[model samples]
Structure formats: C-alpha cells, structure tokens
Target: MKIKKILNNSAVVVKDRDGEKIVMGEGIGFQKRKNDPVNQAKIDKVFVMKDPSEHQKFEEILQLLPEEHIQVAEEIITYAEKEFGVMINEHIHVAFSDHLSFAIERLTNGISIKNALLDQIKILYVKEFEIGLWAKELIKEKLGVEIPEDEVGNIAMHMHTARMNAGNMQETIDITTTIQEITSIIENSLKINIVEDTMSYERLIIHLRFSVKSLLSNEKNHDYDEKMVNMIKENYKEAFACAQEVGHFFEEKYRIKYPEAELMYISMHIQRFYGRVIMS
Candidate 1:
C-alpha cells in the first residue's frame, strides 16, 4: 500500500492492491516515517470504498474536517465493529456515519438515555434499554467523559431496527403510535389525589412500564412463544388489576366515583397495549 494523499499525521488516503481508494489512518498500519513502505500489521480499521472518482472529493473534505471529528469517527467505527458487529465499510452513507459519531460523542460525555418508563419495564422486558445504557456507560468509562443523553432514543431505535425487520418506516411509525396510546392510558388512570407519601403511584408506574416494554419487544421481535405469550397475558391482567385498585383508592379517597373517562382511557391503554404486542 502507498499513500495517495495525507490528510494529517493521523489520517491518509491510500490505494489498495486492486487500485481502490482506501481510507487509512495512523493507528491502522505500523508506525513509519513518511514514504516508508506501509506495514499491514498496524492497520486498525478500513472503510468501504466510495466511488473511485470521489477520492479527490474525500481528500478535500477530510482536510477540512476538524481533527476531533475525525478522531471521533474513527472511534465510532472501532466500537461499532467490536461491539455491534457493524462493518466499517458497510456504513459509508453519510447519515449512518454521522449518527454513529454523534452517538459516540454523547456516550463519552456521561449522558444516559433515560426512559421515564425504564424502571416500570424491567420485569416484563428484562430492561432491554439497559443494553443501550450499558453501551453508553462503557464508552464514558473508556473515553473518560460523559455521553449526552439526548439521543438515547435514537440509539435504542437503531438497535431495535437491527434486531428485527419491522417492515417499512410507515409500519414502524404506526406501531409506535399505538404503543404510546397504551402507555398514556396507564399514566392517566394512575393520577389520583392520594397522600404524597403513598407508594400506589409508584407501583402503578412500574406496572405501566412492564406493559409498554412487553408491547414494544413483542412488536419488534414479531415472535412470542407459548410461554412468553402466557407471560404477557398474566402481566396485562396484573396491570389491569393494579389500575382497578388505583381507581378504587381514588373513589374512596375523593368521595366520588372515578370518572367514566378514566375507565375508557384505561381500556384504551390495555387494548392498544395488547393489540401491539399481539399484532405487531
């Protein structure tokens, strides 16, 4: 291999044996003086070939990118390969590359992807969000900085996308909308003027979490074995019971029947949750 153009001490564009333009960086091959024969042993990563004609374009743009941006790009590529089995070459699209880089930046900055429903869903989904959270934490620990939490949902969505084929983008949007409805029901039904110190609201939130996660996971995976299906039903029953108990608590505490709108909301939530889990 020979350097076709050097962007900086840390990055270069090189030509492979097939005469394809390969993006090479400092950590990729053995360290050597300029013009020395490139050592294959030190190569840290390789990127997919953009059209050969774009080599000049790449070189020109690369020169203008900040060193930090380039460094973060390299780090994202490395982490994707090591953890997520994503090939660097496979992510040549500008959007994918940028997304991965931003995710890394957030992770390095100590930002956690906080889902308000995370605690609630632990029992039903076994904390699938934890996988994304843990990945972020690992990056922070390794890079010695906190990752921002703003894009946690994007990361989780991408991870979910990788796990299953949920059809087209439209289908995914519809499914997600349905899931939100169910969660909203549980949230509304739990609203009661109970003593501030009571744990009823807390327990209700936990149940809602499980219901939402089960719905999401089931939709994403598109598979539910007999045992898993049974588990979901049991969870829904428990969640419904919890909702009813909260309603009763409210009626007794407030000296009025829980409004019919609340029951309608609860029914919608349960139905939508179950529909998503079963049909999606």
Candidate 2:
C-alpha cells in the first residue's frame, strides 16, 4: 500500500489493489508524502470504507479528534469484534469515535449527561454493557479520564447497534426506549411489577426487542385466526388490553402500523408475566 494522502502524524489514506483505505499506526504518516510506501510493520489499523461519504467523514474525524481518543475507540471496536466473534458494522468506527471524543471533551469541561436508561441497558444488553464497562476501563487507562457509568451505557448502546447492524445510534435508542415503554405499559395495565433478572422479565424484553425490530423493518408476523385472537382477547382480558396499549404506543410513536400477531404474542407474554408475578 502507498500513501494517497496523509491524515495526521499517525494516519494516512492509502491505495492498494483492493481499493482506498485509511491506515493508522504510530508515526506512520509522519514526514511522509503522497505515494510513499507504507511501512507494513507500522500499520496498526486499516479501515476499508466502501461508502465515499463515510470514508470522507472518517478522514475529517481523524484530522480533528485527538489521535489518542481515536486510538482508544479503535481498541474498543477491535475488542468488541473479537469478543462477539464477528465483524461489526464499519460505521461504529466513525460513530463511536465521534461519540467517545465528544464524551471526553464534555467530561474535561465538567459537563455530564446521565443515561436515563442505564439500568435498562444493563439488564437488556448484558454482553454489550459488559463490553462497555471494559471500554470504560480502557479509556481510563489510556486517556486518564474517568467516565461515568451512564457513559458506559451510552457506549453499550453503540455496541448493540453496531453488532446488530441496526441502522444508527438513534435507532438503537428508539428500540431500547420502545422496550422500556412496553414494559411500563405491561406493568401499569396488568397492575404488577415485573422484577428484573426473572425468567418472565427476560423473556418479555427479548420478545419486545424482536417485536420492535420487526415493526421497524416492516416485517410481517404470523397472524392468528380471528377466532384464536378472540379467544386470547377473551381469556386474558387484562393482558390483551396491555398489549393493545403497547400496540397503540408503537403506532403513535413510530408511525408504523402495529401487527396484530405481535399484539397477541405480547398479550401471551404479559399473561405469563402476570401469572409469574402473582405466584411469586
């Protein structure tokens, strides 16, 4: 690979037979000119961005954010990929780097934003949250900045979206928010507190997560016959009602038509949750 453009002292754009790539390493770009042969041993990370805009955006990010911050974010991204045993969406490089940079900047200035759904993120996205905690430690070790646990939750959100290839950070936030809202609706409508860590709560969360994804992607669920739907509605009135409330909320919030099959499944889950809560 040869340098096409120098991004900074540690980073540069290179072109090979494969295509254009952003290469980073310690002092790799220092004192280097365009078309310079890249030192293979010095390369630490190489990002092959398929999209032109994404590639350009990352180049801009490297030019602006501190190299240390970018390096730390890259470390976290690498760790996440290895831990999950798969390649994550490439956008995480840009998104997480930008987010981590902003977070470090804010913390330096003594401004903090609490993650309101921190508890939910921990309970719902266990692996991602664990990775986020590891990322927090890595950031502190490398950058000498102690970010709050709320920031850990935010990091977990980024990891979750990247792993799922679920669009962007905002979409992850929307999905998590929808799950919480559905949980609240179930609790309020069924008049029972769904305890975390319990089988029912975990099942409900998983169900809601997939349900939200399906709704967002406009995927159809297996529809029940009218009689079966009526039987469920009649047999589990309160649970069915709670499911309806969730469907209504989804429709209003996401501007997407909520599927009846999803509502039925949600109702069944609610009924099971309520029964478990009542027994406990």
Question: All candidates' TM-scores?
Answer: 0.45, 0.86
RMSD of each: 11.4, 2.7
- Regions more than 4 Å wrong, model 1: 17-19, 27-37, 50-89, 100-131, 138-144, 148-150, 162-178, 185-280
Compared with the true structure, all predictions reach lDDT values of: 0.46, 0.88
Candidate no. 2 TM-score: 0.86
- Cα lDDT tens digits, model 1, 169-263, are 33433444433444454546543222212344344344444433344445332333555444544656644554465456545543444433343
Per-residue lDDT of candidate 2, residues 1-280 (tens digit): 8999999999999998998999999999999999999999999988888788899999999999999999999999999999999999888888899999999999999999988777678877899999999998999899999999999999989998898555777887888887888788888887888887777778888888887988788887766788878898899888888899998888898788787888888888888887676678
lDDT of 2: 0.88
The stretch of ten residues in a row with the least summed lDDT in candidate 1 is: 119-128
Question: Candidate 2, which segments miss by more than 4 Å at Cα?
Answer: 16-19, 34-36, 190-192, 225-231, 255-257, 272-280
